[model samples]
Target: MTEMTYRQALHDTLREELLRDENVMLIGEEIGIFDGSYKITAGLLKEFGARRVRDAPISEEGFTGAAMLGLRPVVEIMTINFSLLALDQIVNHAAKIHGMFGGQLGVPMVIRTPGGGGQQLGASHSQNIELYYAFVPGMKVVAPSTPADAKALLMASIRDDDPVLFLENLALYNTKGDVPDHVEPAEIGKAKVTRTGKDLTLIGYSRMALVAQQVADRLAESEGLDIEVVDLRSLRPLDRDTVIESVKKTNAAVVLEDDWLTYGIGAEVAASISDGAFDYLDAPVRRVAMAEVPLPYAKPLETAALPSIDDVVNAVHETLDAVGRRR
Candidate 1:
């Protein structure tokens, strides 16, 4: 019932989960005395002691693989760009250890990292690696868009049996929203519709959902389009049912995404709509996404690459116009 920043909610969840489970331990850069780069683990070291809240050196691959040897390590990279350093451990060991060893052991680990662009942190640190991780087997990918989702999903990931890639956007750290103390464990592969409507469905992930919500409000006021907005907090094993059901009722859809359009999660959602909800479709599904270029460093070029609220509005209008033309 209290409001908290997404970062605070995450920190609270980590502390609570640690209190609930002794097997859980965290290892990452600056997570201990420094309280994490984003302060998500602030004050945790004081509460749990140094053994639990470890500060690994800059070697992500070494510490990540070593942590997976036994303890249920929660490896939090300061940024997702640094995750590439541990890709071998992630792709080879964490992802394949149990399967390769014929179920002798399971890597009960959680890899947390920050992603996405908007803070002008430049192009190097802003890539959304969800689509890449979704390609690998034996790994679960999650992205929480709200304070509630951030807390609940991270708690669930901590208790999960397999290795999980939990990605938080750098841009969402300061975003404030309501979260309850008595939160339940959220299922990892599910989706939630933040706002319901009958005209059209707007699917978005992470920060893009906020963008779509803004566009949804404008569409209702200006264009009379009662658009439904779906917040897909989980990326891998996605909650396809929520999206399919919304599109069935609305008869049209527009996907808003911040990643490059090619092979992005939005493309997967669009394909599923065409395959599963083809009969209910009134118009071709459209997506508003980043352009296919290495994210630019300059402000103007970066702004042009990313989708905006206006882009979502235009996509909705285009879908409706095409639907009308069919008659």
Candidate 2:
């Protein structure tokens, strides 16, 4: 295994895929000359040349549409905030083409973008709006919290026949972890249990998944509570079974998200637990999420609006206490 940053893992996956498949190409604004907004495509243009590393105008809709028809194009939307510009194409065409046209053709494309607050990019540029795509039916959504998962999931997404929205977290770019020399593609709709505990289950995806791990560690040290963490790697084909099984074992749950609370991904998880494990639940499912407002531009406000380790820890305590399960 080799240790690398989250950004490096993604860059390596793209380079490997491009070399492995003749049809695999990359498209997006400034991806060629500029490398990329976050440098995930750095040095790729020189190796692949202009034909495969073509740059598009500042038209998300136009380029995204072109990618849909192209041969296994991996398009970068710069950031999730900018993906709004291509929502019409993403929701209308790329997602619905296969089902709409009676399976004659499929949009085998990968849209890579980063989201989450903390860089002070302001309300417009910093937001965890992946729920928009996750809510849609046709597209598949996957968010990787670690370098290893990022590499594996990217490989899987590129090879899949359906369109995939690869969600990256801005805060995770510099984070480093050990990744295998040779990795297999991760199954898209599965959730991973990062820790084992019996007190309560802490469930999250993307950045929150990492945060859940941190919370679990702290609870283990401070409160002597065993906290289990489940990482929902794929959001669209959410592994409801994994989540339900974990909650059943723990008898309590706390859902964490980087997005706002209302109608957020946590809501779906909470409902699933209620439907599948209602009788076994010892307490109502709890959720910790970003404040329901445009993420602020100021550092203090942005931090305040986003969910933190403290928020998650507190939620776990409250959930446990609600059912007198706290020791």
Candidate 3:
């Protein structure tokens, strides 16, 4: 095992994959000389040279569509907000190529971009619009909250024979965790139960997944609650069974998300729980999410607009109260 920051894990994994596969290459604006906005590709340009680690013009649509015909391309959009500019290529081309050609061809591409608030980047740059791509049928969206998952999932996304939207929440970049020395590629459509308990389940993805664990720990220590936590690592495939099973065992649930509450990912999860485990539920499912407004630039306003530990804790408490399960 190796302890490293999330940025380091992604950097090392990208380097490793580039070395392992001759056909694998990277594409995106400023990825070559600038080392990427997040520096995940730092030194990669020097090591692999421009052909493999090519920098691109400031055109998301143009560069995103430049995936090599028979090669795996790891494209990085400067930020998730900028991915909107490339939606045509992402949704119409990369996603539909395989089915559009009746399975003769496929787009083995990975689009990596970061999203999330708390950096005070304002609404335009700090939005979590993953649902836009995840809404499409052909894209696989995976958001990793830790360094280990970041490494494993990236490896899997690169090798998979489909377009994968690899979401790297901005807040997790500097966070550190231990990664396996020889990690296997993660199964793309699976959800991981990071914590197991008998009380109500706390479910989330990406940044919220990490927040769920922290909230679960705090509740365990303070309220003497045994809360189960499910990390929805893959948003699109969304392992409903895992979420359903956890809610069944706990008889209640509280969902957390970095996106706004209206029709957000949490709504889908709440629906899945209701569909598969309605009989087991003791109370209405609760959700804690970002305020339904364009995020403000002020740090305090941005912090308030985004979901927080207090919001999650309050939701958990309310759910437990409704079920008469609070200790």
Higher-ranked by TM-score: 1 or 3:
3
lDDT of each: 0.87, 0.93, 0.93
Q: Against the hidden true structure, what lDDT does model 1 obtain?
A: 0.87
Q: Residue by residue across 168-282, what tens digits does model 2's lDDT show?
A: 9999999999999999999999999999989999999999999999999998998899999999999999999999999999999999999989999999999999999999898
Error of 1 at 281 (Å): 0.8
The TM-score ranking, best first, is 3, 2, 1
Q: lDDT at 276 for candidate 2?
A: 98
Stretch of 10 with least lDDT, candidate 1: 63-72
Candidate 3 Cα misplacement greater than 4 A, ranges: none
Least accurate stretch of 10 residues (summed lDDT) in model 2?
Answer: 61-70
For candidate 3, lDDT tens digit of each residue in 1-327? 989999999999999999999889999888889888888999999999998998998898988875538889999999999999999999988889888888898899999999999998889999999999889998999999999999999999999999999999999999999998999999998999999999999999999999999999999999899999999999988899999999989999999999999999999999999999999999999999999999999988888899999999999999999978899
lDDT of 1 by residue, 1-327 (tens): 999999999998899889988888988999999988888899999999999999999998888875445677888987888888889999988889889988888998999999888777777887877787888888899989999999999999999888899989877889999998689989998999999999889999898988888898987887677779999888887888999999999999998888889888999999989988999998899999988877888888888877887788778888989968311
TM-score of 3: 0.99
TM-score against native, each model: 0.96, 0.98, 0.99
